[model samples]
Target: MFDDVIQEDVLLEMKYVYDYVKIETAFPKYATKKALQKYSSPTLLFAAENDVFFPSKLIVPRSEQIFSNLTKTVILQNSSHMQNNANINKILTEIEYFFSN
Candidate 1:
């Protein structure tokens, strides 16, 4: 049950939250290393293989630098900036894996 389901105010707030989620997914989570504390909130990064803007070459390194509890970095093959996500099965399984542990 949601309040103000389609009202302009609610929609604007929703858009802001959605935008934040989309942006945050690109990089890693907050970083704090007590000399590599070894455990932090697990972050799963799904990068589009054909995405020129945020290629694995850039995402991977940036992730490693910040996320101490990096769970996995999955490159979605054949996917681009606006992916229909052909690898739904793989992606879902990875999400399961992330949640299970």
Candidate 2:
């Protein structure tokens, strides 16, 4: 089980992501654009700074264009895809504030 968690198995930024799920970058030009167009709810996107699977640099830019009703987009600095070691206080603060309004 643990052996399956090898780096070679992990999907890179957006490479070959479409084979599994619809995603943008280095593949079809916004293949999920039409899918997102139907979702008009106020959304908040949080990207991890050091996440290779879905890095902030790659995702946030595309999200800005895709999510028409984005309430806010935040890049969690010094963070990664998994939040095992993430700054909990900061995360809570952001979530609290976003929903508080």
The C-alpha lDDT values of all candidates are 0.68, 0.69
For candidate 1, lDDT tens digit of each residue in 1-101?
12112556656877898877655445554455554576567789988766766766667787788777777899876666544424667889889988998
Supply the TM-score for candidate 2. 0.61
Clashes of 1: 0
Q: RMSD in angstroms, candidate 1?
A: 8.8
Q: List ranges where model 1 is wrong by over 4 Å.
A: 1-39
- By summed lDDT, the worst window of 10 consecutive residues in model 2 runs over 1-10
Superposed Cα deviation of residue 64, candidate 2 (Å): 1.1
- As a whole number from 0 to 100, the lDDT of residue 69 in candidate 2 is 86
Report lDDT (Cα) of residue 94, candidate 1: 88
